[model samples]
Target: MSGADLSRLSLNTATVKHADLRTAVDAAASAGYGAVGLWRDRVQEVGAERAARIVAEAGLRVSSLCRGGFLTAADDAGVEAALDDNRRAIDEAATVGTRELVFVVGGLSGSSPGGPPGAATDRDLVATRSRVADRLAELAPFAEARGVRIALEPLHPVFAADRAVISTLAQALDLAAPFAPGAVGVVVDTYHVWWDPELRAGVARAGREGRLACYQVCDWILPLASDALLSRGHVGDGYVDFAAVTTWVADAGYRGDVEVEIFNETVWDAPVAATVATVAERWERHVAPHLAPSPGAGMRLLDAPGERP
Candidate 1:
């Protein structure tokens, strides 16, 4: 694909966190990316207003906010606090002109601070998922009113005990189905869902139901470490076949930006500019070819006239 064609790819800021928000945005824009996926902490670090200005000035689109979940807890007070935080996050995304807010639906209530410690157990996993769904139902209307779509990201099952209770696209869709149309959706991250036995069916279901909001691309590795959360592989460096996954999504009618969301510590240790450049290059060479619009393809990349070449 041409550089212009590669412009459809977006860089999620976590892929290059060695730099601050301003530096990451600058690098993404300089590398000819169309959009960026942002993390709330980074925005807060730089000040949301300043971050908004920087992104707007660089002509970079905020593809999606990295997070707004963790609303599920063991108590009402914690859930309320999470809702309040989510409202603020919505405001930030609106201020930055982003349309989607990715949510990592949190784990059992007692697993984290503010949670009822020791309440999380294998026996309570189902109850925890129900709690998350109820919370999502409450927050969906608030997000919808702000024009921010909630993209529920299902984390790997390895994180089922502590990171996210929603661990599969199927579960995410079921939880989101109670909401009004377009209010809730799922974020398909290759790193998280690559090992799912029902991945293709889940992608199809997401696309068929119009519940696919964000498509984050990354690779997964084996000999998995038990303690590392940021050791994700770059595109094509691991076992995932991006070609097949993107084709499945494209066939299912998704036409949004293909976000490169590598959270690998190795990538983060590199200079921001180098990391962004390498991600953009790898995305084009490995992932873009799969998502490219062919004459008979079901969906096409949104036309980006005047985008840098």
Candidate 2:
């Protein structure tokens, strides 16, 4: 296989929840990753100022922030609060030098009478989608002003009931179309979108329209767990074919970082260093080979530390 650059691999902080923000950044740097993705809560915990310094000191690129979602609460007060929070997230991203703020637009307010109250009933899905789009409209300008792109990540259908009504890439792109170029776009997370029937088409559309701002990788399992939110699999552990997905992404002209943003309980339980090392190894052994040139080619794969192999 031809050599491929592993410098494009990024570590999303949530993958190593065992560590704090500074430690996560340091670990990613030490592990030879090209960049690191941060979580807002962790940044808050470490104090944004300190977190920013650590990342910069490590010479790590802040790829994107994990979230600035929950912008679709039922009441105006909740909506306002979400907006305020998102603005702060944007500020934080800017301070940390991240170019994108990933958003998981939240689900409806209140649980269903029989099940999760926040799960949208047939009557409310459309309205909820509209509210989310409107909220995005309201915040897009401010985010753009701060030089932060809003990457609207369409969570999987499993999360449609309680996380986001926008469960498809098509819908996310449509929602972002109203905003300026690069101002609002969609994040393609393999865990959420790998099963989409229109996955290739959606990705092609994203590329065609220049709306593909972020790309995340994780795995999805069959016999989905009773609780779907936290059961994400690692890169090669489950059903997702990262080789195919990566091909499509690269073919679609996405030259951005391929971020690994797993939130599995199993991964989180491991020590942060072990977790980072495992992800790096997985990226090299599994994901990287597929991106290499055809067999018999003579090329050197770029190492994780930005050195050519």
Whole-model Cα lDDT of every candidate shown, in order: 0.79, 0.79
Q: Please list the residue runs of candidate 1 whose C-alpha ends up more than 4 Å from where it truly belongs after superposition.
A: 1-4, 113-123, 293-309
Give the per-residue lDDT digits (tens) of candidate 1, residues 1-309.
235565677888888876778888888888789888888888989877888888889998888987888876667788789889888987887777788889987876667533335634334887878888787878888889988888899998878767898889998888888885478889999989888999988887776677888899888876664544775878878899888888877766677888988777778788887777778777877887777444554422223221111
Please give the range of 10 consecutive residues that has the lowest summed lDDT in model 2. 300-309
Which residue pairs does candidate 2 place in steric collision? 110-117, 110-118, 111-116, 111-117, 111-118, 112-116, 112-117
- The per-residue C-alpha lDDT of model 1 at residue 37 equals 85
List model 2 lDDT by residue over 1-309, tens digit each: 213355778899888877888788888887778888899888889777888888888887888887887776767787889989999988988887888899988776553322645334344777878888888888888999999999999988877777777899999988988987568878999999888889987876776677778889888875666567677877788988888877666655567787898877778899888887878877886677665433322222121121111
| Candidate 2 TM-score, C-alpha based | 0.88
- Native-to-model Cα distance after best TM-score fit, residue 21 in candidate 2, in Å: 1.3
User: Which lDDT value does model 2 have at 157?
Assistant: 85
